[model samples]
Target: MGQTIIEKILSSHSGQEARAGDIVVAELDYVMGQDGTAPLAIRAFADLGGKDVFDRERVAFVIDHSAPSPNEGVSALHKLMREFSREKGFKLYDIGEGVCHQLLPESGEVGPGSLVIGADSHTCTYGALNAFSTGVGSTDLAGGLISGKMWFKVPGTIKFVCNGVLPPGVYSKDLILYLIGRVTADGATYMAVEFTGEAIGALSQEARFTISNMAIEMGAKAGLMEADDKTFAWLRRFTSRKFTPVTADPDAVYTRVLECDAAKLEPQVARPHRVDNVVPVSGAAGKPVQQAVIGTCTNGRLEDLRIAAGILGGRKIHRDVRLIVAPSSRRVFLDAMAEGIIQTLVEAGAVMVTPGCGPCVGTHNGVPSDGETVISTANRNFKGRMGNSNAEIYLASPATVAASAVTGKITDPREFI
Candidate 1:
């Protein structure tokens, strides 16, 4: 079949051929729920006359957003979800450990080629594991609970080629930020992005994920890369179960095409509330930074940690600001400790946290106070995205964030070296 990555993934879940623009109702292998959406989804499921979930063990209900449940409204929602999941027997990961997407993969509930649905917008994070995953609203999730399926209009694919060696400070995060800046948030609306070329082949699964994780920021439905040796290596560590590796056909038709050159890039950031608003680190240099978070699903991988540790190895964070580092998974947390990255960060006064979706999603652990200005590695810095309505978030790569943490200001990473 001359299919693209999106079609290949969807076709596996569905028993029939799936092409671009075709309507599909594939059975969900897994469904995910987090605090903000789970409550409404469960309520909708009850309102729609669904008896029980399709499968209790197959569903993951996590308390991610509003982690400590900021106020009574959010706390009540948390209470309602806990009661529902426990009563109905759905898997519940209470307010502990990793973000929803980070926790799902860590628990081994999802695998390559599996179809997963979630009630959160960042649900696309599962694509890092080569699963055909996407986000859905609470209402759609309510319907899927009873029917065990959901409708998706198969999207056409876009081929993105990345070539050449990367510049010293340029990382996958900068690459994606640059791409999103150029493509604009709506550039790939309704399309899947398939990363190719020699550079993508050279990247680790974590690096590839840094690209796909922000695909939605560019308005792409799913961002995918070829399942290569790196993908297999990551999978091997996570799963002993053997499975076939899926790849797009050579002649797969694409709706659009774009290419990226890593050698020409530098550390970039998405300023303010919109992800599409990107600029070089130099432009944001000398700007004041009251906080810096160096870890999140978007940049919480091992290499990301190494980069930050290297920068913070000998320096302490600015006394005027705060720096928080959270591992993406238990595995990642353990690896960092074994590699001494953890010590380097903690010695520098960084608040190392267990793997959880804290702070990044504007929940607990790292919420900025009102009028605070912070530089972070997480995606999205929308207005009030952090708890305080007056908080301002500037998204940057791990290197930039680490450097800014050390300098107490938004200085370019190149300044540190």
Candidate 2:
């Protein structure tokens, strides 16, 4: 019996043959905590009487969730994190650096075959680099900080093989939304998802990151793509880290195998209150929107920004719509600025915000009022996710968001492209 990618990674880290359901304590390559969770983790570490972290260089604290201090409470938390980081010698990414998931990889802390964990649920975003990453609670992160290790019950694998070229205006976001709709939220609970096939190979690094970042929405334990030339090339641009790419064996066991043709996929949208409540763009078109947000860890990469800029160039957002554009990282923001994407978006009536989580976490920036409808590129669309239970959030690709912003309605991106 050959091992899947997750199995192989775990086996290597645990020094034993790993399989689904096997509980083992594996050494972690990296551990991270965001502002929303780091305080709890720090308290837990103190309660455990921790004098020093096992590996200060391997731990990080990212201040993004309530960046710029939404209030005094959050500002105090940021101060606490900064003080702790200085004391422990752990890396700290301050506000405006970007979301943890986006900045972590950009900093070269993540790579193939690494075991990474974060206090944020979207930690699975690193799986796009073929790393075995997942989210843990504050206490778990505290434990990892102390021991540089964490326990895991290996998960079964679900293989998604996507082939064929994607049609114009359809993107990785659409493919993920379609899959989540098919599986329904919680359908793949705690299962490892491995994406493969020609279409995945053809996707840019940004698209791959977008796909892996949203696996949690479908209840996946970890969403991964086999590392290839593209993955290595992207990593090279960030760091000189030496990594041996890991791939599932040809005969690796899988709980299920799904085949998809990307050419047939359409732009997908997740309606209010539920990520699985997805529909084709055409089916949801003509619905009015009051706001549109074009950025997040899920789809706020440079490629996503360019896509939105292309759609909005030479056109202004509808008078009734308020559009917000937030790049995922400072590096992305600079690159976009150099390319004039930021200028184009701003000229088209989009408000450019800091390179952080922005409206995605609803902690600050771009929260909608009651009865408003918002189209966003963020991952989740649960009720009240954007700070107000009465305001509805619709999740879509950046292109779709830009198009809808231009029309003040739910418009198909294909119409604009």
Give me the candidate number with maximum TM-score.
Answer: 2
C-alpha lDDT of all candidate models, in order:
0.81, 0.93
Superposed model 2: Cα runs more than 4 Å off: none
Q: Write model 1 residue lDDT over 152-220, tens digit each, in one string.
A: 899998888888866777788888899999999999999888777877776777787788788888888
Using all chains and alpha carbons, the TM-scores for the candidates as numbered come to 0.94, 0.99
Off by over 4 Å in 1: 70-72, 369-371
lDDT over C-alpha atoms for residue 184 of model 2: 89
Q: Write the per-residue lDDT of candidate 2 for residues 1-417, one digit (tens) a residue.
A: 999999999999999999999998999999999999999999999997878999988999999888889889898999999999999998999999998889989988799999999999999998999999999999999999999999999999999999897898999999999989998899889899998998889899889999999899989989999999999999999999899889899999999999999989999999988999999998889999999999888988999999999999999999999999889999999999999999999999999888888898788898899999999999998888989989999999999999999999999999987
Clashing residue pairs found in predicted model 2: none
Question: Could you tell me the C-alpha RMSD of candidate 1 in Å?
Answer: 2.0
Checking candidate 1 for backbone clashes, the offending pairs are: 98-355, 98-356, 98-357, 99-356, 99-357
